[model samples]
Target: MDHPPRIYCYRCRKPDLLCICADVTPVPTRFGIVILQHPQESRRTISTARIVSLSLTGARLFVGLDFAGCTALHSHLAAAPGPVYLVYPERGALDVVDVMAREHGWPDGAPTFVIIDGTWAQARKIKNQNPCLDRFERVSLSPGAPSRYRIRRQPRGHYLSTVEASVLLLSRLEGSEEAFRPLLEVFDRMIDRQLSFKSGESRRGVRRPAPRPEGG
Candidate 1:
């Protein structure tokens, strides 16, 4: 039998009751963000890329796998008032610390980060397909703690959700923790809300197993 279509919140794109849109004060950062999401990631209700888009002031999320010649995506980069950087590579990319030390424009919020959101395999495919993204200066993070996202299984303990990664990257690059607190607050709420909902469903004896989501 076909399941009834779930009613969704148009803004956050979550099921209406599961929406985490309350008290979301868009976090403003010195730098900008652009998320190139895999089409598959866009289908996951638990995906945090939407959270980054809704909770960040100057961030944008575009859903696709390849965007090498995407007119809009490339045009936005060209029009950016500052530089752009891609985030990836387990190694060899410039460390976030080094970029702060070496890049003069970054201090003035002149660098926008472009992140690819998807499963590890999917993110790899997206990057390989997009030459426009590969050509940018890539940046990597040194995780201080394990990922806080418990519901999803990460390929590694240090893999962070999209919002978490954005929060860490911007907070470090801009040199302020307090400025990005609201984003984390919202992230916690979403995780808590989902946890509660799932537990409640179990208590009610909904036997269907939940599908595992990929790390953002």
Candidate 2:
């Protein structure tokens, strides 16, 4: 049983066969996207957080369980052009669109969006551990098109993948659906590839399901 070590693409951190590096077409965004990904999720082959980071010029990915003492986190917060906002569904979390109307609209810079990329439980853990994030207003998105993440079992229909949520958040916030469309393009491509990979396995008569990592 001497299987060869899998060669990985450093840029996308995916195996060369499943690499998404070629599909990454960077999309410019008006607001900053800071994705705080749980360390475990970073190691997953189908990480959409990587796609969001790769496809958006304004996106920054930080991998950690707790960001309490992360220098880059603090520096990013300090350097935000406008108010900082956390995109988590919390009690009384305002709607992203409504926030614009309530504040009479941000003519210049919209708040930087901090998206926690993990399962619901893991997301809660990250927020609780990062007390610094408590200072920011929490905003949630109104559900859009149903999640296209059919590869996993989601608790609900609106439960989106990390990049799917990013597409909705950015497209709506910037008032241009077209700009963020590329994020989904890459997201869908990844899903298709994974499905194809599994099909190939099934053709060889593999019975077990592939592991599904939680994100968004």
User: lDDT of all predictions, in order shown?
Assistant: 0.84, 0.85
* Backbone clashes under 3 angstroms, per model: 0, 0
Using lDDT as the measure, which candidate wins?
A: 2
lDDT of 2: 0.85
Q: How does each model score on TM-score?
A: 0.90, 0.91
Off by over 4 Å in 2: 103-105, 206-216
How does candidate 1 score on lDDT? 0.84
Q: Which candidate tops TM-score?
A: 2
Candidate 2: residue 193 lDDT (0-100): 91
Worst-scoring 10-residue span by lDDT in model 2: 207-216
